[model samples]
Target: MNRHRLRLVTFDAFGTLFRMREHPALTYQRIAQAHGLKVVSEPDRLKASFQDAYRKQGASNPVFGRLSQGSRPWWKSVVRNTLIGSGCPKADVDGALDPVFAELFDLYAQAAPYEVYPEVVPVLETLRTTVCEDKVPNGMGKGTKFWMGVVSNSDDRTEAILQSLGLAKYFDFVLTAYHFGSEKPGRGIFDEARLLARNCKAEECLHLGDDLERDYNGPKLIGWNSVLIRRNNDHPVPAGVATASSLKAAFADD
Candidate 1:
Protein backbone atom coordinates (compact mmCIF):
# COMPACT_ATOMS: atom_id res chain seq x y z
CA MET A 1 0.00 0.00 0.00
CA ASN A 2 1.19 3.50 -0.84
CA ARG A 3 1.51 5.46 2.40
CA HIS A 4 1.14 8.74 0.58
CA ARG A 5 -2.32 7.93 -0.70
CA LEU A 6 -3.69 7.28 2.76
CA ARG A 7 -4.48 10.38 4.77
CA LEU A 8 -6.20 8.75 7.71
CA VAL A 9 -5.73 5.46 9.58
CA THR A 10 -8.23 4.28 12.15
CA PHE A 11 -7.88 1.32 14.49
CA ASP A 12 -10.20 -0.87 16.48
CA ALA A 13 -9.74 -0.44 20.22
CA PHE A 14 -9.85 -3.84 21.91
CA GLY A 15 -8.04 -6.84 20.38
CA THR A 16 -6.06 -4.47 18.20
CA LEU A 17 -4.14 -1.84 20.10
CA PHE A 18 -4.57 -3.37 23.56
CA ARG A 19 -6.15 -6.32 25.33
CA MET A 20 -7.18 -7.28 28.82
CA ARG A 21 -4.26 -8.44 30.92
CA GLU A 22 -6.30 -11.42 32.07
CA HIS A 23 -9.68 -12.91 31.45
CA PRO A 24 -12.45 -10.56 32.57
CA ALA A 25 -14.06 -13.45 34.35
CA LEU A 26 -11.05 -13.70 36.62
CA THR A 27 -11.33 -10.05 37.46
CA TYR A 28 -15.04 -10.42 38.12
CA GLN A 29 -14.45 -13.45 40.29
CA ARG A 30 -11.77 -11.67 42.25
CA ILE A 31 -13.98 -8.68 42.81
CA ALA A 32 -16.86 -10.88 43.85
CA GLN A 33 -14.65 -12.67 46.33
CA ALA A 34 -13.60 -9.34 47.80
CA HIS A 35 -17.25 -8.46 48.29
CA GLY A 36 -17.90 -11.83 50.00
CA LEU A 37 -20.00 -13.10 47.17
CA LYS A 38 -18.89 -16.58 46.28
CA VAL A 39 -19.21 -16.97 42.57
CA VAL A 40 -18.70 -20.21 40.65
CA SER A 41 -15.39 -21.91 41.43
CA GLU A 42 -14.50 -22.26 37.76
CA PRO A 43 -13.53 -19.09 35.90
CA ASP A 44 -14.67 -20.45 32.57
CA ARG A 45 -18.20 -20.82 33.80
CA LEU A 46 -18.21 -17.24 34.95
CA LYS A 47 -16.74 -16.17 31.64
CA ALA A 48 -19.46 -17.96 29.71
CA SER A 49 -22.13 -16.45 31.92
CA PHE A 50 -20.65 -13.00 31.44
CA GLN A 51 -20.71 -13.41 27.68
CA ASP A 52 -24.29 -14.46 27.71
CA ALA A 53 -25.34 -11.58 29.90
CA TYR A 54 -23.37 -9.12 27.78
CA ARG A 55 -25.00 -10.33 24.59
CA LYS A 56 -28.46 -10.25 26.08
CA GLN A 57 -27.95 -6.78 27.48
CA GLY A 58 -26.54 -5.54 24.19
CA ALA A 59 -29.44 -6.88 22.22
CA SER A 60 -32.02 -5.32 24.50
CA ASN A 61 -30.15 -2.11 25.21
CA PRO A 62 -27.60 -1.47 22.48
CA VAL A 63 -24.75 1.07 22.64
CA PHE A 64 -24.36 0.36 26.30
CA GLY A 65 -27.97 1.36 26.75
CA ARG A 66 -27.48 4.89 25.52
CA LEU A 67 -31.06 5.22 24.38
CA SER A 68 -33.34 3.38 26.79
CA GLN A 69 -30.95 3.43 29.74
CA GLY A 70 -27.47 4.70 30.62
CA SER A 71 -24.10 2.92 30.45
CA ARG A 72 -23.66 2.57 34.20
CA PRO A 73 -27.04 0.98 34.75
CA TRP A 74 -26.57 -1.18 31.68
CA TRP A 75 -23.24 -2.44 32.95
CA LYS A 76 -24.67 -3.00 36.41
CA SER A 77 -27.42 -5.07 34.88
CA VAL A 78 -24.85 -7.11 32.99
CA VAL A 79 -22.83 -7.69 36.13
CA ARG A 80 -25.92 -8.56 38.12
CA ASN A 81 -27.02 -11.07 35.53
CA THR A 82 -23.51 -12.47 35.17
CA LEU A 83 -23.19 -13.02 38.88
CA ILE A 84 -26.60 -14.62 39.12
CA GLY A 85 -25.94 -16.84 36.10
CA SER A 86 -22.59 -17.84 37.60
CA GLY A 87 -24.43 -19.24 40.64
CA CYS A 88 -24.04 -16.41 43.10
CA PRO A 89 -27.07 -16.27 45.38
CA LYS A 90 -29.37 -13.49 44.22
CA ALA A 91 -29.65 -12.11 47.78
CA ASP A 92 -25.87 -12.07 48.23
CA VAL A 93 -25.41 -10.51 44.82
CA ASP A 94 -27.92 -7.79 45.52
CA GLY A 95 -26.15 -6.94 48.75
CA ALA A 96 -22.67 -6.73 47.21
CA LEU A 97 -23.26 -6.01 43.54
CA ASP A 98 -22.86 -2.27 43.94
CA PRO A 99 -19.36 -2.35 45.36
CA VAL A 100 -18.42 -5.23 43.13
CA PHE A 101 -19.58 -3.44 40.01
CA ALA A 102 -17.98 -0.22 41.19
CA GLU A 103 -14.60 -1.84 41.55
CA LEU A 104 -14.94 -3.65 38.25
CA PHE A 105 -16.00 -0.44 36.54
CA ASP A 106 -13.04 1.49 37.89
CA LEU A 107 -10.67 -1.34 37.09
CA TYR A 108 -11.72 -1.44 33.44
CA ALA A 109 -11.85 2.34 33.03
CA GLN A 110 -8.06 2.57 33.56
CA ALA A 111 -5.01 0.73 32.30
CA ALA A 112 -4.73 -1.67 35.20
CA PRO A 113 -6.58 -4.40 33.35
CA TYR A 114 -5.11 -3.89 29.93
CA GLU A 115 -1.76 -4.53 28.24
CA VAL A 116 -0.73 -2.63 25.15
CA TYR A 117 0.69 -4.81 22.44
CA PRO A 118 4.47 -4.31 22.18
CA GLU A 119 4.43 -3.33 18.50
CA VAL A 120 1.60 -0.81 18.93
CA VAL A 121 3.70 2.15 19.99
CA PRO A 122 6.43 1.68 17.40
CA VAL A 123 4.01 1.12 14.54
CA LEU A 124 1.95 4.17 15.55
CA GLU A 125 5.10 6.26 15.73
CA THR A 126 6.15 5.18 12.25
CA LEU A 127 2.72 5.91 10.84
CA ARG A 128 2.46 9.30 12.51
CA THR A 129 5.90 10.50 11.37
CA THR A 130 5.90 9.07 7.87
CA VAL A 131 7.27 11.60 5.42
CA CYS A 132 6.07 11.75 1.87
CA GLU A 133 8.79 12.52 -0.61
CA ASP A 134 6.29 13.90 -3.11
CA LYS A 135 5.03 16.41 -0.56
CA VAL A 136 8.50 17.87 -0.04
CA PRO A 137 8.17 19.84 -3.27
CA ASN A 138 4.98 21.42 -1.90
CA GLY A 139 6.89 22.75 1.16
CA MET A 140 5.34 20.07 3.37
CA GLY A 141 8.33 17.96 4.25
CA LYS A 142 8.07 18.45 8.00
CA GLY A 143 5.96 15.29 8.29
CA THR A 144 3.34 13.33 6.50
CA LYS A 145 -0.17 14.83 6.68
CA PHE A 146 -1.40 11.58 8.11
CA TRP A 147 -3.95 11.31 10.91
CA MET A 148 -4.65 8.44 13.27
CA GLY A 149 -7.86 7.75 15.13
CA VAL A 150 -9.75 4.96 16.83
CA VAL A 151 -13.18 3.71 15.78
CA SER A 152 -14.43 1.11 18.17
CA ASN A 153 -17.69 -0.53 19.17
CA SER A 154 -17.29 0.51 22.76
CA ASP A 155 -18.49 3.13 25.18
CA ASP A 156 -16.97 6.51 26.05
CA ARG A 157 -14.73 4.88 28.65
CA THR A 158 -12.53 3.92 25.69
CA GLU A 159 -10.89 7.33 25.68
CA ALA A 160 -10.03 7.12 29.36
CA ILE A 161 -8.66 3.61 28.90
CA LEU A 162 -6.51 4.74 25.99
CA GLN A 163 -5.28 7.77 27.91
CA SER A 164 -4.42 5.69 30.95
CA LEU A 165 -2.45 3.37 28.66
CA GLY A 166 -0.55 6.42 27.26
CA LEU A 167 -1.89 5.69 23.78
CA ALA A 168 -4.31 8.61 23.41
CA LYS A 169 -1.54 11.01 22.39
CA TYR A 170 -0.97 8.99 19.24
CA PHE A 171 -4.51 9.51 18.03
CA ASP A 172 -6.06 12.64 16.63
CA PHE A 173 -9.56 11.44 17.54
CA VAL A 174 -11.30 8.52 19.19
CA LEU A 175 -14.81 7.77 18.02
CA THR A 176 -16.88 5.27 19.92
CA ALA A 177 -20.10 3.63 18.88
CA TYR A 178 -21.76 4.88 22.03
CA HIS A 179 -21.25 8.48 20.97
CA PHE A 180 -21.30 8.07 17.20
CA GLY A 181 -24.58 6.09 17.18
CA SER A 182 -23.07 3.49 14.89
CA GLU A 183 -20.85 0.43 15.17
CA LYS A 184 -18.52 -1.46 12.85
CA PRO A 185 -19.66 -3.78 10.03
CA GLY A 186 -21.83 -0.79 9.25
CA ARG A 187 -21.02 2.18 6.99
CA GLY A 188 -22.03 4.89 9.46
CA ILE A 189 -19.15 4.57 11.88
CA PHE A 190 -16.56 4.39 9.10
CA ASP A 191 -18.09 7.44 7.45
CA GLU A 192 -17.99 9.25 10.78
CA ALA A 193 -14.29 8.43 10.97
CA ARG A 194 -13.73 9.93 7.52
CA LEU A 195 -15.60 13.03 8.61
CA LEU A 196 -13.44 13.29 11.69
CA ALA A 197 -10.36 13.12 9.47
CA ARG A 198 -11.37 16.32 7.71
CA ASN A 199 -13.70 14.55 5.31
CA CYS A 200 -10.97 12.51 3.64
CA LYS A 201 -12.13 10.39 0.73
CA ALA A 202 -12.94 6.78 1.44
CA GLU A 203 -10.18 5.46 -0.82
CA GLU A 204 -7.65 7.67 0.97
CA CYS A 205 -8.44 6.10 4.37
CA LEU A 206 -7.17 2.89 5.91
CA HIS A 207 -8.32 0.90 8.93
CA LEU A 208 -6.57 -1.82 10.89
CA GLY A 209 -8.39 -4.20 13.19
CA ASP A 210 -8.72 -7.83 14.31
CA ASP A 211 -12.14 -9.01 13.28
CA LEU A 212 -12.41 -10.25 9.71
CA GLU A 213 -15.96 -9.05 9.12
CA ARG A 214 -15.86 -5.82 11.11
CA ASP A 215 -12.28 -4.69 10.49
CA TYR A 216 -11.45 -6.10 7.07
CA ASN A 217 -14.64 -6.64 5.13
CA GLY A 218 -16.52 -3.69 6.67
CA PRO A 219 -14.07 -1.06 5.45
CA LYS A 220 -13.50 -2.81 2.12
CA LEU A 221 -17.23 -2.84 1.40
CA ILE A 222 -17.23 0.93 1.60
CA GLY A 223 -14.11 1.60 -0.52
CA TRP A 224 -11.70 2.09 2.36
CA ASN A 225 -8.46 0.10 2.56
CA SER A 226 -8.25 -2.34 5.46
CA VAL A 227 -5.87 -4.88 6.93
CA LEU A 228 -6.83 -7.72 9.25
CA ILE A 229 -4.41 -8.32 12.12
CA ARG A 230 -4.36 -11.96 13.23
CA ARG A 231 -1.78 -11.88 16.01
CA ASN A 232 -2.47 -15.44 17.14
CA ASN A 233 -3.10 -17.12 13.76
CA ASP A 234 -6.54 -17.93 15.13
CA HIS A 235 -8.24 -18.07 11.76
CA PRO A 236 -7.59 -18.55 8.05
CA VAL A 237 -6.93 -15.65 5.71
CA PRO A 238 -9.60 -15.22 3.11
CA ALA A 239 -8.85 -14.68 -0.58
CA GLY A 240 -7.67 -11.17 -1.55
CA VAL A 241 -7.82 -9.87 2.02
CA ALA A 242 -4.75 -8.15 3.48
CA THR A 243 -3.55 -10.18 6.47
CA ALA A 244 -0.85 -9.51 9.04
CA SER A 245 0.33 -11.30 12.14
CA SER A 246 0.77 -8.00 13.92
CA LEU A 247 0.58 -4.26 13.38
CA LYS A 248 4.33 -4.31 12.69
CA ALA A 249 3.78 -6.73 9.84
CA ALA A 250 0.63 -4.97 8.66
CA PHE A 251 2.55 -1.90 7.60
CA ALA A 252 5.92 -3.51 7.05
CA ASP A 253 5.76 -2.35 3.43
CA ASP A 254 5.24 1.24 4.46
Candidate 2:
Protein backbone atom coordinates (compact mmCIF):
# COMPACT_ATOMS: atom_id res chain seq x y z
CA MET A 1 0.00 0.00 0.00
CA ASN A 2 1.30 3.45 -0.87
CA ARG A 3 -0.26 4.89 2.28
CA HIS A 4 0.72 8.23 0.86
CA ARG A 5 -2.47 10.12 1.66
CA LEU A 6 -3.09 10.67 -2.02
CA ARG A 7 -6.88 10.98 -2.38
CA LEU A 8 -7.04 12.41 -5.87
CA VAL A 9 -5.00 12.00 -9.04
CA THR A 10 -5.03 14.27 -12.06
CA PHE A 11 -3.54 13.96 -15.54
CA ASP A 12 -2.93 15.97 -18.71
CA ALA A 13 -4.51 14.86 -21.94
CA PHE A 14 -3.09 14.91 -25.51
CA GLY A 15 0.64 14.18 -25.35
CA THR A 16 0.22 12.92 -21.81
CA LEU A 17 -2.69 10.52 -22.35
CA PHE A 18 -3.45 10.26 -26.05
CA ARG A 19 -1.40 10.42 -29.24
CA MET A 20 -2.40 12.15 -32.48
CA ARG A 21 -1.92 10.95 -36.05
CA GLU A 22 -1.72 12.89 -39.30
CA HIS A 23 -3.98 11.39 -41.96
CA PRO A 24 -5.08 14.77 -43.34
CA ALA A 25 -2.84 14.52 -46.36
CA LEU A 26 -5.09 11.87 -47.83
CA THR A 27 -7.97 14.35 -48.07
CA TYR A 28 -5.82 17.30 -49.12
CA GLN A 29 -6.01 16.40 -52.79
CA ARG A 30 -9.81 16.47 -52.82
CA ILE A 31 -10.00 19.71 -50.83
CA ALA A 32 -7.55 21.34 -53.19
CA GLN A 33 -9.48 20.19 -56.26
CA ALA A 34 -12.67 21.70 -54.87
CA HIS A 35 -10.92 24.95 -54.01
CA GLY A 36 -9.13 25.14 -57.39
CA LEU A 37 -5.74 25.24 -55.70
CA LYS A 38 -3.12 23.30 -57.66
CA VAL A 39 -0.19 23.71 -55.26
CA VAL A 40 -1.78 21.62 -52.49
CA SER A 41 -1.50 18.60 -54.76
CA GLU A 42 2.00 18.29 -53.37
CA PRO A 43 1.28 16.16 -50.31
CA ASP A 44 4.77 16.79 -48.94
CA ARG A 45 4.18 20.56 -48.92
CA LEU A 46 0.79 20.13 -47.27
CA LYS A 47 2.19 17.84 -44.56
CA ALA A 48 4.99 20.32 -43.79
CA SER A 49 2.62 23.29 -43.57
CA PHE A 50 0.22 21.25 -41.47
CA GLN A 51 2.84 20.25 -38.91
CA ASP A 52 4.44 23.70 -38.74
CA ALA A 53 1.22 25.59 -37.89
CA TYR A 54 0.11 22.76 -35.65
CA ARG A 55 3.15 22.59 -33.36
CA LYS A 56 4.07 26.28 -33.53
CA GLN A 57 0.61 27.27 -32.32
CA GLY A 58 0.29 24.51 -29.70
CA ALA A 59 -0.22 25.74 -26.12
CA SER A 60 1.02 29.16 -27.25
CA ASN A 61 -2.51 30.48 -27.84
CA PRO A 62 -4.07 28.02 -25.38
CA VAL A 63 -7.69 27.91 -26.64
CA PHE A 64 -6.75 27.96 -30.30
CA GLY A 65 -4.21 25.22 -29.63
CA ARG A 66 -6.80 22.82 -28.21
CA LEU A 67 -9.33 23.35 -31.01
CA SER A 68 -6.59 22.82 -33.57
CA GLN A 69 -5.66 19.51 -31.95
CA GLY A 70 -7.30 17.18 -34.46
CA SER A 71 -7.52 19.57 -37.35
CA ARG A 72 -4.96 20.61 -39.94
CA PRO A 73 -5.17 24.12 -41.35
CA TRP A 74 -5.92 24.47 -45.06
CA TRP A 75 -2.87 24.73 -47.29
CA LYS A 76 -4.29 27.95 -48.69
CA SER A 77 -5.03 29.28 -45.21
CA VAL A 78 -1.46 28.55 -44.32
CA VAL A 79 -0.31 30.17 -47.54
CA ARG A 80 -2.67 33.08 -47.14
CA ASN A 81 -1.48 33.87 -43.65
CA THR A 82 2.16 33.49 -44.60
CA LEU A 83 1.68 35.58 -47.73
CA ILE A 84 -0.46 38.13 -45.95
CA GLY A 85 2.17 38.58 -43.30
CA SER A 86 4.72 38.81 -46.07
CA GLY A 87 2.72 41.79 -47.50
CA CYS A 88 0.44 39.97 -49.93
CA PRO A 89 -2.77 41.83 -50.97
CA LYS A 90 -6.24 41.34 -49.43
CA ALA A 91 -7.60 40.32 -52.82
CA ASP A 92 -4.63 38.00 -53.35
CA VAL A 93 -5.15 36.32 -49.99
CA ASP A 94 -8.98 36.24 -50.10
CA GLY A 95 -8.99 34.97 -53.66
CA ALA A 96 -6.21 32.56 -52.75
CA LEU A 97 -8.56 30.60 -50.53
CA ASP A 98 -12.35 30.22 -50.35
CA PRO A 99 -14.14 28.41 -47.55
CA VAL A 100 -11.01 28.36 -45.38
CA PHE A 101 -12.80 27.31 -42.19
CA ALA A 102 -14.65 24.42 -43.84
CA GLU A 103 -11.44 23.10 -45.33
CA LEU A 104 -9.79 23.24 -41.91
CA PHE A 105 -12.67 21.31 -40.32
CA ASP A 106 -12.61 18.68 -43.03
CA LEU A 107 -8.90 18.23 -42.47
CA TYR A 108 -9.57 17.96 -38.75
CA ALA A 109 -11.95 15.04 -39.23
CA GLN A 110 -9.43 12.94 -41.12
CA ALA A 111 -6.85 12.45 -38.37
CA ALA A 112 -7.16 9.75 -35.70
CA PRO A 113 -6.65 9.81 -31.95
CA TYR A 114 -5.16 6.82 -30.17
CA GLU A 115 -3.34 5.94 -26.96
CA VAL A 116 -0.20 7.86 -26.23
CA TYR A 117 1.51 5.15 -24.26
CA PRO A 118 0.22 1.55 -24.40
CA GLU A 119 0.75 1.10 -20.68
CA VAL A 120 -1.90 3.66 -19.64
CA VAL A 121 -4.81 1.26 -18.96
CA PRO A 122 -2.69 -1.26 -17.07
CA VAL A 123 -1.02 1.48 -15.08
CA LEU A 124 -4.33 3.12 -14.21
CA GLU A 125 -5.79 -0.28 -13.32
CA THR A 126 -2.90 -0.95 -11.00
CA LEU A 127 -3.35 2.48 -9.43
CA ARG A 128 -7.12 2.12 -9.01
CA THR A 129 -9.60 -0.60 -8.11
CA THR A 130 -12.90 -1.63 -9.67
CA VAL A 131 -15.76 -1.88 -7.22
CA CYS A 132 -19.06 -3.83 -7.12
CA GLU A 133 -20.32 -6.27 -9.77
CA ASP A 134 -20.38 -3.75 -12.58
CA LYS A 135 -16.64 -3.13 -12.20
CA VAL A 136 -16.82 0.63 -11.93
CA PRO A 137 -13.36 1.97 -11.18
CA ASN A 138 -13.02 3.64 -7.83
CA GLY A 139 -9.51 4.85 -7.28
CA MET A 140 -7.19 2.81 -5.05
CA GLY A 141 -9.33 1.89 -2.02
CA LYS A 142 -12.60 0.06 -1.62
CA GLY A 143 -15.89 1.94 -1.05
CA THR A 144 -14.27 5.38 -0.91
CA LYS A 145 -14.92 7.44 -4.04
CA PHE A 146 -11.62 8.61 -5.36
CA TRP A 147 -11.43 11.84 -7.28
CA MET A 148 -10.01 11.67 -10.79
CA GLY A 149 -9.79 14.72 -13.02
CA VAL A 150 -8.15 15.86 -16.23
CA VAL A 151 -6.62 19.35 -16.65
CA SER A 152 -5.95 19.74 -20.30
CA ASN A 153 -5.73 22.18 -23.19
CA SER A 154 -8.14 20.70 -25.71
CA ASP A 155 -10.99 21.50 -28.05
CA ASP A 156 -14.62 21.17 -26.91
CA ARG A 157 -14.56 17.84 -28.69
CA THR A 158 -12.19 16.43 -26.06
CA GLU A 159 -14.95 14.90 -23.96
CA ALA A 160 -16.40 13.13 -26.99
CA ILE A 161 -12.97 11.82 -27.95
CA LEU A 162 -12.40 10.55 -24.43
CA GLN A 163 -15.76 8.81 -24.46
CA SER A 164 -15.14 7.36 -27.90
CA LEU A 165 -11.85 5.99 -26.63
CA GLY A 166 -13.79 4.36 -23.73
CA LEU A 167 -11.84 6.37 -21.15
CA ALA A 168 -14.75 8.47 -19.88
CA LYS A 169 -15.68 6.09 -17.07
CA TYR A 170 -12.31 6.21 -15.31
CA PHE A 171 -12.58 9.84 -14.32
CA ASP A 172 -14.85 11.75 -11.96
CA PHE A 173 -14.25 15.28 -13.24
CA VAL A 174 -12.53 16.43 -16.40
CA LEU A 175 -11.39 20.01 -16.93
CA THR A 176 -9.99 21.33 -20.15
CA ALA A 177 -8.16 24.63 -20.43
CA TYR A 178 -10.10 25.41 -23.56
CA HIS A 179 -13.32 25.48 -21.53
CA PHE A 180 -11.60 27.52 -18.84
CA GLY A 181 -10.28 29.95 -21.50
CA SER A 182 -6.76 29.50 -20.13
CA GLU A 183 -3.87 27.07 -20.24
CA LYS A 184 -1.50 25.53 -17.73
CA PRO A 185 1.53 27.47 -16.33
CA GLY A 186 -1.18 29.98 -15.42
CA ARG A 187 -2.34 28.09 -12.25
CA GLY A 188 -6.07 28.87 -12.47
CA ILE A 189 -6.94 25.32 -13.48
CA PHE A 190 -4.61 23.84 -10.88
CA ASP A 191 -5.98 26.05 -8.10
CA GLU A 192 -9.52 25.09 -9.07
CA ALA A 193 -8.54 21.42 -9.13
CA ARG A 194 -7.21 21.61 -5.59
CA LEU A 195 -10.48 23.13 -4.39
CA LEU A 196 -12.41 20.50 -6.30
CA ALA A 197 -10.42 17.75 -4.59
CA ARG A 198 -11.56 19.11 -1.20
CA ASN A 199 -8.07 18.65 0.11
CA CYS A 200 -6.65 21.81 1.64
CA LYS A 201 -3.16 20.47 2.12
CA ALA A 202 -1.09 20.09 -1.05
CA GLU A 203 0.53 17.06 0.58
CA GLU A 204 -2.80 15.22 0.45
CA CYS A 205 -3.15 15.17 -3.35
CA LEU A 206 -0.81 14.54 -6.26
CA HIS A 207 -0.76 15.76 -9.86
CA LEU A 208 0.91 14.04 -12.80
CA GLY A 209 1.34 15.29 -16.31
CA ASP A 210 3.70 15.53 -19.29
CA ASP A 211 4.12 19.29 -19.46
CA LEU A 212 6.52 20.70 -16.91
CA GLU A 213 5.80 24.40 -17.17
CA ARG A 214 2.02 24.06 -16.91
CA ASP A 215 1.58 20.76 -15.06
CA TYR A 216 4.50 20.93 -12.66
CA ASN A 217 5.14 24.62 -12.16
CA GLY A 218 1.52 25.71 -11.79
CA PRO A 219 0.54 23.17 -9.12
CA LYS A 220 3.87 23.26 -7.36
CA LEU A 221 3.55 27.02 -7.03
CA ILE A 222 0.48 26.55 -4.85
CA GLY A 223 2.18 23.86 -2.72
CA TRP A 224 0.54 20.78 -4.32
CA ASN A 225 2.82 17.77 -4.44
CA SER A 226 3.48 17.21 -8.15
CA VAL A 227 5.42 14.77 -10.28
CA LEU A 228 7.03 15.41 -13.65
CA ILE A 229 6.35 12.47 -15.96
CA ARG A 230 9.49 12.73 -18.15
CA ARG A 231 8.07 15.34 -20.50
CA ASN A 232 7.86 18.15 -17.93
CA ASN A 233 10.86 18.11 -15.52
CA ASP A 234 12.89 21.10 -16.64
CA HIS A 235 13.13 22.85 -13.28
CA PRO A 236 15.32 21.91 -10.36
CA VAL A 237 13.31 19.74 -7.97
CA PRO A 238 10.96 21.80 -5.85
CA ALA A 239 10.83 21.32 -2.09
CA GLY A 240 8.12 18.92 -0.74
CA VAL A 241 7.48 17.49 -4.22
CA ALA A 242 8.18 13.83 -5.14
CA THR A 243 9.26 11.89 -8.21
CA ALA A 244 8.29 8.53 -9.71
CA SER A 245 10.06 6.61 -12.44
CA SER A 246 6.72 5.57 -13.82
CA LEU A 247 3.07 5.19 -12.76
CA LYS A 248 3.71 1.43 -12.75
CA ALA A 249 5.83 1.94 -9.67
CA ALA A 250 2.94 3.74 -8.01
CA PHE A 251 1.06 0.42 -7.93
CA ALA A 252 3.69 -2.19 -8.59
CA ASP A 253 2.61 -4.76 -6.02
CA ASP A 254 -1.06 -4.75 -6.85
Best-fitting candidate, scored by lDDT: 1
Clashes of each: 0, 3
Q: Local error of candidate 2 at 59, Å?
A: 9.4
What lDDT does the true structure give each of the candidates? 0.87, 0.58
Q: Cα deviation in Å at residue 34, candidate 2?
A: 8.6
Candidate 2 residues 124-151, lDDT tens each? 6644563312222233344554567788
| TM-score between model 2 and native | 0.64
Measured on C-alpha atoms, candidate 1 has an lDDT of 0.87
Name every residue pair that clashes in candidate 1. Answer: none
Clashing pairs in 2: 71-108, 185-214, 212-232
Residue 189's lDDT within candidate 1 is 94
Q: What C-alpha RMSD separates each model from the true structure?
A: 2.3, 6.8
